[model samples]
Target chain A: MMNRDELRTALIEEITRVAPDLSADEITEEASLRDDYDLDSMDSFNLASAIHKRLGVNIPETDFARLQSLAQLMTYLEKHPA
Target chain B: MSDFLMPSLGADMDEAVLVEWQVKAGDAVHRGDVIAVVETAKGAIEVEVFEEGVVEELYVPVDTTVPVGSPIARLATQASVTPASHTPAEPEAAPNASVEADWQPEPSARPALEVSARTEKNDRISQTPTTPPERLKASPLARQRAARTGQSLADVTGSGPQGAILAGDLTSAAPQAPAAAEPKGKKSHAGFNPAEMRKAIAAAMARSKREIPHYYLATAVDMLTATHWLEAYNADQPPEKRLLMSALIFKAVAKVLRDFPEMNGYFQEGTYQPSPSVNLGIAINLRSAGLITPALMDADKLDLAQLMTNLQDLTRRARQGGLRSSEMTRGTITITALGERGVDSVYGVIYPPQVAILGFGKVSSRPWAIGDALAARPVMQATLAADHRVSDGHRGGLFLDRINQTLQDPEQLNQPAHQESES
Candidate 1:
């Protein structure tokens, strides 16, 4: 089982690891990772790898399409526990 | 005894400053052991010694700039009697293995003899020689590992002689969590000046355009089938495991390269040598300035999933300035994709020695004609820039057509690849 704050912190850490250009504060919960960080598909894939490495969850490609923001990723992680 | 010469990293590289020695006198080193670190136009490269032996003497000291192919150190090779008798504990089979090794002349062997007018002449006109600067004593591999882990060497206390940094020092210096958080600020300490990188790129591209007789070709490919296949394939998987359009493109290019060997190797000294393996050079743009195209080794043999993983790793390492000496030089054919940036098409200049470069544009929907009907379909432009000396327009066109055909049947990309990809 996962909580909201834990998931958010993990996602933020993963994002920061993949795209060092973006700060933790800049990656708002509501803003899309692509829009805010210029996270193209490659960057998105890297983020996914980071998440998999950290949380031990394989985020499906379909689920990736739905995850536009940090909030969505956090929610998805909460629902699909590692 | 054999001379360990300074290796020429690329056609554009003429000289490099010997940064530090990873090995010392009386150190028992193997064939592939990294003996020294040298700072080239590209960056810090841990130069490997190809011959197994003990160091007899280091001809040139650290912080001295030397010409390419100049003898940097002398190795008392196993071929010699005294060294072989002295190193009796070493694996006997390892010494004799070179006798059974492939007869093909090593490209790096005798760099002085192999220096051609094209590259050596290019180096004279374009090379910007820099005086050796005082650098932190660390192996190139250590530096790369440090960068990858988001740990900086600035604060780490070295364990090697004279407090020289080593890879082992990085792990204990900083814990992973807090160090990862501070990745951004520490990257600037890499000491990579964007201006120097720009000049290096300029020299390489200038030499490429001037020396290599390049012919360009482009084909508009329909991506509807591949798109649908990707969607269906990824529907069941998590976001982390999804396949992108670029991965498909890379797979297609790698597969097509197998059929057309002429477009997949280095053209050195007016001779076109075909490589047995398809080591795809992926052009990754650094955030600072210019780009570094590191090879995705044995790409043709990797399945689609493996390709994605390797590409991600290669790009991450490239951007971070953590590439190794071999990855920086061993590219057969290059693939440059501008699709993610929404560019319509990219016509790239062929990196010298490599005969060809494959380019991919953005994947977007456009009205396309199919027989008697017209429909809005996903289309992307694939471009090829090839050396005219090795391949004609027909061969280049066929290569592009093969890639398009492969992508049309994207299912093959996921299939188990041929086991043997090497010569």
Candidate 2:
């Protein structure tokens, strides 16, 4: 199991993989990936799947919309322990 | 037995430099093998061979700039057909890294951008050559860097095979050039120069508008049924397997194209040739480079899931510079969809040799009329920019409307598409 710091790093990696134009320096923990970074619907879906593949977490459609921010995504991952 | 020539990437390209050889002499290769990587104005493209054979000889050395259709290699397809093809079949003797790099096209030939004339266009580039023009041997990389750093090739001495100039030669000769001053990481981040790419795109668009008489049409599609269907369809699927709404749009357009053959093929030399298959050129935006619209070949044939997989694979490979020659050139028509983050509607300029281009904009919540009452619903704006010589506004309108109608029956999209007019 990855610790808190490692989990945050993994999530950011997934985000950048989808949105190559985005950088780690500009991303804030509480900011929305779509609202802040301009990731489209397909990009968002790809990010979700990429995260699922990397961390072994299955994100449901209802919960995907809720986990828009890094903090929310990390917290959900920690709770689920996937 | 046969000479494998350098292929022209598309109407946008003139020539390419052999970047590297993936297969050497004596190597057995099958059809669709990526035997070489060549760099064009649009970064490196993996060159795939169509014939199954043994590599008999490597003619062009790595880093040598060869014209489109120039013989780059010799393949032994049949043992009896090789006429004095005796080159010892030795891989080590073949030009690897240190070949004559100073292969440059004559100044006049380099500037011959003959994309405007209507007669014998793309075929002219591939057919019989009128004596390979006198060339000043210089690697394309060195030439581009030389132009960037204001270093003239005439002044530089070549150390490569046959005294041809190479990229390494430029840095050592002109230590003060900006190409040397830049940090290592920054150079890669600055992918194939965007300024040059912009120039190429601008020229193509300008020529397309100048030469092709275009008629435009747009329609607003209500996605209440389609979006709901997509949502329901994806509800049971995992994240990896879930399909994008655009994939459905691709499948729908491909299906509707069968009924409207006029809007689904190429137009050149005062003739409209409707292709036997629907090769939808999809515009994929690259983070490093500008944009490339390679074909999602035979988009009309694949089911939703297979189409989704190909689209995703094409997108990934396109970004990574792993595209084939046919995908780069043989697109019957093009579809440009501005993703969810883009504007409400898009009107595209038709890619040349192709008669029509379809554009899709972001799906937004708009006031839609249901019976006498009006309510907000998910709506997408679809537009068509087609050649006036080939298709009329009436045909274009029906084409757009069919796409909208096809989306209303999303379940039908999951089933196999009946192959149409093209063989």
Candidate 3:
């Protein structure tokens, strides 16, 4: 199972890769992904691919659709703990 | 009369549901006319008539599903009719007759025919109990080549002993020669690849940015009224029938597009070619496949219930990679919403030939000036990308204005309250 802190760090790192202008400080555990960082659909897809490659976790399309904020995504990752 | 077998829609489709019967028994169906609607993994697709004739039989009923390649209906020709004896053994006769006809070619035309005949005679002798061939059998290459081409081993000629077939003889005797002109060094660069997907994105985005001059217009619409309306509506609705904000947006978009037909077209051949019907393509992200845009046909004609059904069907098939070729084709406009994804604003690229693409961002709590006071309200962001070639900036602005107006007022959307309640 992935640890919460590690998962959060990985998520931040992945997000930063797509949006190079975005910094790690911009994304927090509880912050809204869309409001805090302008991650659109393509960015979300890229992040999902990055997570799959790094964490070996399969996020189904439905789950990806439901993920809204950093907190929600973290909770989802835990439930589907990889 | 000859039976007309169902044409395979594609290599992937295994079975198709007979959604509707376009021609009843005894009705004449012309070639290329839609005879029935088949519901495959893709969507409800219309099957066209291949042969023109009177519909003699309805083997499959409406809503009844049949396997692909199975005869769903039969056509009557001028030929004499035979009793319905569609047995497993029937298919064999057709293939055998064709095979026999295929074999009746001029002997002199084929140089290796005499050698093949001699080899077959030798093989028959060697197989007999009285005598055995000195050699163990055929070469590995010859056997592999024969298997690959579906050629009979006995039919191959031999350059060897008392007429023993060798690999070279078999290769020469092969009726169809593999094309040597085909460039073997070059790899197959066709079909779907990652580079292609990226290129498609690049092309679409480039076209959207350059030709379809887009103007960004953001509006803060109060969802509280819509929220209250939804809550009251959902209380009476079954859990399954409950309307999502996405559905409301879809209905609003449909209604708005009906008013402005120009927005429901593509900029083709230096002119705006408006479509007769409104087919909306929704972009869905799949895990395995990067992203897919599956279309919902006749969105303007569908009721709320039918729209919901179509949405569910499109999304389901999209994820399964079972979308039909037609579903991805002929989309007049596109609507993409990151409703639950929680994005505040997204500037979407116009899907080509399409005049506009509507993008919906997530609803979030933001401070708003309500009358004279500041208040926190749930508001969403919408961006419309319009084809500058067909529509001017003023017309695009007007279209967006209509969409915003419709979405803000829930009562306007729920015009037929009686119909909603009955459902």
Q: Pick the candidate with the highest TM-score.
A: 2
Poorest lDDT segment (10 consecutive residues) of candidate 3 chain B: B86-95
Give the lowest summed-lDDT range of ten residues in model 1 chain B. B87-96
After superposing candidate 3, which stretches have Cα over 4 Å from the reference?
A1-82, B1-199, B415-423
Candidate that would win on DockQ = 1
Residue-by-residue lDDT tens digits, candidate 3, B1-423: 344544444222344456456688899865456776654433345566534578877776664556544556667654342222211111111111222111011122212111112233234333322222443234333443454567665555443434444334444565374413223211110011222244445655665566567655665667767767766775565434555677677878877787788888656446676766677878765321245566787676666667775776666455422344345545778888866565687777777657788888887888989789999887887778776667777877788788778877877676653453244
Q: Write one digit per residue (lDDT tens) for candidate 2, span B89-177.
A: 11110112122111111112222222222221122222332332233344434555665687766666554434445455666667687
* Candidate 1: stretches off by over 4 Å: A1-8, A25-32, A75-82, B15-21, B37-43, B57-67, B80-191, B236-242, B419-423
True contacts kept of each: 0.53, 0.39, 0.00
Give the interface-residue alpha carbon RMSD of model 1: 6.8
Tally clashes: model 3.
3
True lDDT of residue B294, candidate 2: 85
Off by over 4 Å in 2: A20-23, A35-38, B78-191, B416-423
Each candidate's DockQ: 0.40, 0.25, 0.03
Tens digits of per-residue lDDT for model 1, B55-111: 877777765777765677767676533322322111111111222111111324443
Select the stronger candidate by lDDT from 2 and 3: 2
* DockQ, prediction 1: 0.40
Tell how far residue B70 is off in model 3, in angstroms: 23
